[model samples]
Target: MKFGVQYYPEHWPRDRWAVDAKMMQRAGVNVVRMGEFAWSAYEPKEGALDFTWMEEAIALLSSHGIRTILCTCSRTPPPWLYQKHPGIVNCALNGNTQPTDERYRVGLAHGEFIAEAQRIDGAVIRHFAGNKHIVGWQVDNEIGASNDCFCPRCREKFQEHLRQKYSTPGALNEAWGSHFWSYNIEDFSEVPTPHKRAQPLVEYRRFMSGLNVEFSRWRADLIRELDPGKLVTTNYQNIHAQHTDCHALGRTVDVNGMNHYPARTPELAIDYYRGARGEVWCLEQHTRLQHHDTPAGRMRLWAWMAIAHGATGIVYFRWRQCRWGQEQFGDGLLPHSGEENRFYGDLSRIGAEIKHLGDMLAPTRPRAKAAIVFSYESRWSFEASGFDRGLGPVTEAVDFHKALSRRLTAIDAMDPRENLSAYRLVIAPRLWMVDQRIADNLRSFVGQGGTLCLTTASGVVDEYSKSFDTPRPGRLQDLAGVTVSDLAFDKALRLPLASDVIPDLDGEEGSLLADEVHPTGATVIATHAAGWRKGSPAITMHTVGKGRVVYVGVRLSPEAVQTLTNWLCETTGFPKPFELPNGVSACERACDDYTLLFFINYRDDPQNVQVGEGWIDAFTGESVAVAEVPANDLRILRSGK
Candidate 1:
């Protein structure tokens, strides 16, 4: 695996470069990611470009056995370019133009902006095309971190996009179901920027979200055309930033990559970005959160967590804290005064450990027999509906993933459209909108002997963000063998629910929304214990073809959900391979030669995991019957297959 640090050579003096390089070499950081936000430094004035400094920096690092992953500097344009073309400045949804001084916020789809970005980007690529030590190219810094523009130009482009998709205003109106408040339009140009309205909002969300993918692909293709051999990728924004569809971006790039903050972002994000590609580079691993100090051991623990979830590369976000900037007290390997602290100690330890374990760990990817499906369209649809809006589709997916990961070795967080042949149990939570393709894919999975679990508030709308004329649970009713009669979504109105398959919560009142499910030919496994809707089915199961479909008609607590996942294994007749203690997890990764399991303890103290037999410590090469993982640390065990 590539062990590296994100270095900003422009931020420091030329003389200090050797000191940082030597420190990196001492710590086993073999690669450095630079130039992510150094456009101004590259081109001090428009048309006055100099790549000599960066070349010197790369050569300096290379002398110490450290390569570079040069990032295209287009994301941070030089000040002069913006001063020349003020029209490219970003505009918010409220019609206010954002200041050009901002780093990432820009009118990404603006014509002049694209031209300028491409100019600088093309220059950077051509300048570094022949660098032998460069291992990869990050197209842009963090593609989805910027806000989507709502300027007049974006309005025009959205209209053209709708015109191409719908072909006619009438068809667009029909698909959007715009007749509710006479929101119908005669021309595609009549559509306004997304601020109100359901259908248009969802379409706008999708359209604007796709711009990130389009932009990344443009850069990636440019890199391949100019510098072809190395990998091309873009670090995605934090998982909570739903502005862009990550799965789509992952598919577009040559390799999937992400900026991961382990403290703030959930661990599922590491697995989510890994997706079908099965490997992701954690481009920006956090050492601290927003000037606050992270716990002593967490930085190393988070790195191992990423590696466990199939991170082929771990590049700490930065090498040094900036002396003066908006992000002054930021996460860095070294403090602002270039002083070594506990962070450096933690960093050196991780570097030393990965230096020994990287080869065996990097070659192996995560393995999962079960998956939790998430959809951007479904999430967008829920956003359009503007109802029952508490925890959104993302929370639902993450929660289910966490619950399953607790019991199972590793659980995949996948897009519904991805391949389902490899998984035996697939949990799709809150599938609010169902397209023909989505419905067909899910139904086929159930038909092909896959246990599919779906939740409430699903199947209310079609792909076009219009209500389905059919019964509730729209396209999945037959496959699920249950039709939703009605739903109760009052957060305070917790119904007393009981389940035979899941553990009892001692009248804790977990089900948030109760769907009065009327099963056509399925078994009712759970029902309302005591309520106005008492005896009504809250959960159901129906055998379909060689498999079955379990329908959760209500949102249950995290504990209840995990218990239900256990029941899924029981029904599928597949025993869970191993179970770890709470606050500890084991991820299985393997190749043709061997299988490895990384036991990670998330608690504050040490924890032990049973290794059974035939397993040797990956680093020590000593057989272990029981492995004790340090607090916020990990132990890797390898077995020849």
Candidate 2:
């Protein structure tokens, strides 16, 4: 595994370079990701490119055994470029042009903007192509972070995209069901930017997602062309960022990278990124609080959490916090004074431990028997439809995942369209947009003996973001063995629900939304205990082939949902290999030769847990049958086969 930090050489003086290099060497830092936001430093003026300073810095770092992961530096274009092409600024959905002063404001769909970005990107790649110390390339710093442009160029491109997708305006109109409001168009160009209409908004969402993928693909291809041997990657933000489809973006890179801020983002964000690819890198890991101080050992704990979820490379966000700029207060391993702090000690300890365990942990990947399926399209479609303001798909998915995480190891939170045959159990929460392909995929997965669990608000829409005329869940009614007869979505309405299959939540009240399910041949596992819709099926189970499908028709309490998730896990016969106490989690990454375990204590109090025999603590190199995990700390262990 690679242990590194993000270093901004341009931010400091030349004399400080060697000092940072020596400090990194002592801390077991092997890599430094640089130049992501340094376009202005590289090209101070138009056509006045300078690579000598960067080359010197790279050479200095290489001398200290620290390699570089150079970034293309196209995301934040220099001020001169923006001044030269002011038209590159993005236009927001409300018809206001975003100022070009902000980072990542270049319109991706703008042809001239692309040409300029490619020019600077190509220059950077060609300049550093032969640099031996550079291991890989980060295409851009979080592609599509601020690239959502609703300008005329984007509208034209969107129209062109729709034309290519439907081949005719009439077909597009029919697919979008635009005739309902007499909104049918005679030409694709007549379609405006995403507005009040559900179909156009969802389609535009998908189109923007595609544009992000295409943008990354272009950069990755350019990198490969310049240096075919080097790996290409781009940093992805939290999973809920709907501008880009991460799974699609991952296909364009050699490896997926993510920015991990445990305080702001959930732990499952790492899993989602890993699921986007197979293994991932923590490209920008928070080492301290923005303004406040991080509790001791918390940074190390978060790093281990990432590794536990299959992070092959862990890079702290920055070596030192910036003294000036927008991120002046964003703390790092070292304080603004460039002095050693608790974060430095924590980082050095983790780095040394990683250096010792790198070989054993490198080959091992996360293997999970169960998965939680997530879809951006489903989320986009549902959000566009404005069914419920509080219905957050990512939050709901995370709730189920957290429940499963208490008992399971390495539960994959991935896209629903990914291969599912390997998983024994799969939970898809709020799968609102179910198309023929999605429906068939779930049917096939369940048919092949995989237990599938789907939650409420599923199967409401088809591929075009249009509601189906048939019963709810659309094409999945037969597979689910139930149809939603009436949806009770009133804020004051709550169902007193009971379940025999999951008896732990019996007599529990469920609210937010409830689908009164009429089971055809399926078994009513749960029903409303007391309500206007009393005795109605709130949860049902159907045995399709060798497998079964469990349908949850209402949003239950977090505790109740957990009980149901645990019931599903038990039903699938998933092995509970690690028996961990509450507030402690054991994540396993195994290879043929050995199994690596990361024990994380999430509470303020110490946690004492018994480890299985033949396990050795990776940090202390001691054989132990019992381990005491400290508060907000982590322990890594390995066992030979």
Candidate-wise lDDT, in order: 0.83, 0.86
Model 2 scores a C-alpha lDDT of: 0.86
Clashes of each: 0, 1
Candidate 2's residue-wise lDDT over 1-641, tens digit each? Answer: 87899999998999999999999999999999998998889899988999888999999999999999999887788888888988888888887988776788888888788898889888888889978999999978888898888989889999999999999988998898887878889998899887888899988988888988998898899889888899888899777688889889999999989999988887788888898355998999889777675678889888989999999989999999888877887757788889888888988898888888888788999988888897888888888997753585787888888888877878888888888888889889889899888888899999899999988888999989998999987899999998987766778877777777678878677888888788887899988888567777889999988999999999878888878887887777876546678879888898888888888998999887787689888767788687778888877887843
List candidate 1 segments past 4 Å from native: 388-390, 503-508
Q: Highest lDDT, which number?
A: 2
Please give each candidate's TM-score. 0.97, 0.97
User: What lDDT score is found at residue 151 in candidate 1?
Assistant: 92
**What stretches of model 2 exceed 4 Å from their correct place?**
388-390
